[model samples]
Target: MIGARLREWARRHSDKGRYTPVGIIFHWVMAALVILQLALGWYTTRMYAGGDRLTAYQWHSDLGLLILFLAFLRFAWRMMVPGPINDADKGGWQTNIAYATHVVFYLCFFGLPITGWMMWSALGDGRPLYVAGLVPWPQMPFGGLDPQWQWAILDWAEDLHQMFILILIILIPLHVGAALKHHWWDRDDVLEGMLPDVKDADDHREGLTHKPKRPRSPRVTGAG
Candidate 1:
């Protein structure tokens, strides 16, 4: 009986096309972290210098690593349980564009932190990264280059890191705008699907004590 009830519950949820609870949690957590990291990155670069700059860099590095770890976990979860089916009524071009956008986001999520790590490693300044000023974080292996090449490699990595940041700066706003467009303009559940702790009217109706009435079938008439 328990197994049958669980199967029925799964069927009902799958039919509604909503994301699984794990997916919703991961999505929102990562979204908040990414936003925080971006704000920290922009503020630290613009406001701090000298020792203050180094301290800010430590925070930025710590947050970047955290994001990197979460990004991998989120990717794994996504692979384990696929997202909802795409809207069949939407045009092929729009669907393809959405897929491409997601691909770019995943690439950035992985790429930005890695380049930042490389930049720090290439510097070889011997300053340790302490997570929340507690545990010492491990440095990447690129720290031991010859003095002649160290600065050159640091410069390259720094450039790449900044480039990825710039890409994110552009892409994130566009992504948010598109989600808002779906929610407000198109009046769809695209945005709500990824959020937690809120259910749509249909979901509420599904949970009601009374059964819903079924619509009547139209009477068929033979053509003369």
Candidate 2:
């Protein structure tokens, strides 16, 4: 019953060509965390090996775990309440590609944190782990393993972590470009759906020379 109520609540917003507030919060919060993590990761790479570097790394790991936790919640939310169908949902190869891109993003959302956890565990430094420096987290069961195997795990996790990061580096630009194109060049509500308390250009001109008229009916009508 709760799930049904939640879905109905989400559907009301989705029908208006917007994401539910819960979904929007999850999206932007995770997005902010991800950008912060990327910047922190870059900063840590340049810092000399010392206490400060270790502190940075500790914070990074804490954030990664926080991301992992939020990702789980977000994924569950997604499963319970599907995303809105905006202009970008037009059925075509482009739409298919967009769907694939989302799948990869969810993979990265899960992959980065898991691999980072593995790497930290493999290091066997015996440092305590936490989620956002609050929730106590356990390391992977690597402490009992032999040194050679621990090294192997460390090497494997490091490679995977870098691979995920590289993939994100490539995808983020394209994603931003696509959103901007939908918003500006195409003059669509695709970007507005993810934005909070923001209506499409047609609803509020903001600063445009002339106000665009809103459509009375759905533009595309198929089960989203």
Best TM-score among the predictions, by candidate number: 2
Q: How much is 110 displaced in model 1, in angstroms?
A: 0.8
lDDT of 2 by residue, 31-77 (tens): 88998999999899899999999999999999999999999999999
lDDT of 1 by residue, 113-161 (tens): 8888777877888777654456677777656678768888778888887
TM-score per candidate: 0.79, 0.89
In Å, residue 104's CA in model 2 sits off its true spot by: 0.7
- Once superposed on the true structure, which residue ranges of model 1 sit more than 4 Å away at CA? 1-14, 86-89, 130-135, 197-204, 207-224
Error (Å) of candidate 2 at residue 90 is: 0.8
Q: Cα miss at 36, model 1 (Å)?
A: 1.6
**How many residue pairs collide in each prediction?**
0, 0
lDDT of 2: 0.89
